[model samples]
Target: MSNKTILITGCSSGIGRVTAKYFQTKGWNVVATVRSNPEAQTELNTLENVLVTGLDVTNENSVSTAISEAIERFGRIDVLLNNAGYGSYGVLEATPEQVIRKQFDVNVIGTLLVTRNVLPYMRRQKSGLIINISSMGGKISFPLGSLYHGSKFAVEGMSEALSFELETIGAGVKIIEPGMINTNFAETVGAAFNVDPTQTEYVAFVSKVMEGLETANSNHSEPILVAETIYEAATDGKRQLRYIAGADAEKIIAARKQLNDDDYMMLIKQNMGL
Candidate 1:
């Protein structure tokens, strides 16, 4: 049994929800937050040592309020998990500017905002961890995944830089790069199809990529695996900055490291049947 506290975002379902329950079961105070409709979260609300709240990571006021509430309830925050992100896949030319901006706003800016808001408390405490839930997409790219991949790549960069500065303050930063967790997040990734039908060439390419993704997604790792990995990163007491969670992610990232850029690009094209 432990008395530490963890604040997680995007707990409406999937990884965030499972992680909240997992930590609570381990006797950690869990602050579970959603973008909206916090009142309807009966399951987490009923759990002991859990605070169910509303936190739109993109909103500064919402971010501040959630942090204040967490500190008030738990006296301190030991871990902050920036897990509130959705994938929007579309070609750069076909994706509307607003959609592209929104993707960065949620996936990149939201992570930054939440992390900034929590840093003060963590710095004051002099010992805390910030875990950003990136994806294998951060390291590699796919067709029509420009929006999603760009944002995740930005997170990867930001986390790496932040990790260096945070170490001096006795705080650590960890990035979880999961390949494909069996969650509705895949549907969210595939739902954004902006390829113009009139552009027959782009449309054909997009179709093939989506088809390949559908087959790849059929074998997804469970969300618990990711949650368990997050727990390890939090307690492992190592200087490791990135934790690859899924088997697929491990293999793919390993291959990415071994191959040169041209070879990797060719492999990606072949995999997508391009």
Candidate 2:
């Protein structure tokens, strides 16, 4: 059994839950966090060498308490996977201020909060890996994805710069930029649409844009693909910065590299039929 340990957030379901289970099966200790403790979590509750804690990353108290609990149980933490995030897709002008704030809070600020708390433990060990879960959307943007894409772009930039700072301390930083993965996150995004009936001026255009988005997401990789990538990111022992997950994710990112801004935007619009 590898004595190595990984601390992951947002484990109630989706990528977080799958990643937690993946590490446990690999003989690594796992600390999985959910927003609140339920009576039971069938998938994660039964796993061995795993600790489930309540953590609301946006809240300082929740973040610190979870870190303390994990350290107390495991003695040390080897990896910190900031996998807690959600998307709120909608028209920019119509989207509520609180909703946009919450989106950034969970995706960007929450990532920093969790990382800030775990850095001390990893620094003390003098060796660690921090993998922030970004998305292909981070590099490529689409209509109604402005809010979601902005947060991911922020994370992508943050991880890149932080890698330089952590290298001197023997700790490493990596980003898992996953494409469309089958998860509840898609359902959440679908539901975040808050259309304004009075503001029907943009309705027809928005509908077309959404149709294009649906086409873009028609084929998505399973969450395990991303979980496996996360596993590789943790164990690879290399300073690789961005590990792209899905096949579409790879293709899109490669295209992004070859195309300039205008071309990329045109390609995205064409692909999505916008």
Which candidate wins on TM-score? 1
Please list all clashing residue pairs in model 1, or write none if there are none: none
Residue 61, candidate 2: how far off, in angstroms?
Answer: 0.7
Give the deviation of candidate 1 from the true structure as CA RMSD: 0.9
Top of the candidates by lDDT? 1
Candidate 1 lDDT by residue in tens digits, 1-274? 9899999999999999999999999999999999999989999999999999999988999999999999999999999999999788866777788888889999999999999999988888899999999999999887778788999999999999999999877899999999889999877765766777776767777888888888778878999999999999988999899999899999899999999999999998898898
Candidate 1 CA-lDDT value: 0.91
Per-candidate Cα RMSD to the true structure, in Å, reads 0.9, 1.1
Which tens-of-lDDT digit does each residue in 189-260 have in candidate 2?
Answer: 877785677788888878888888777687899999999999998887776899999999999889999999
Flag regions of model 2 displaced more than 4 Å. Answer: none
Question: Which residue runs of candidate 1 sit more than 4 Å off their true CA positions?
Answer: none
TM-score of every candidate: 0.98, 0.97
Candidate 1 is scored at a TM of 0.98
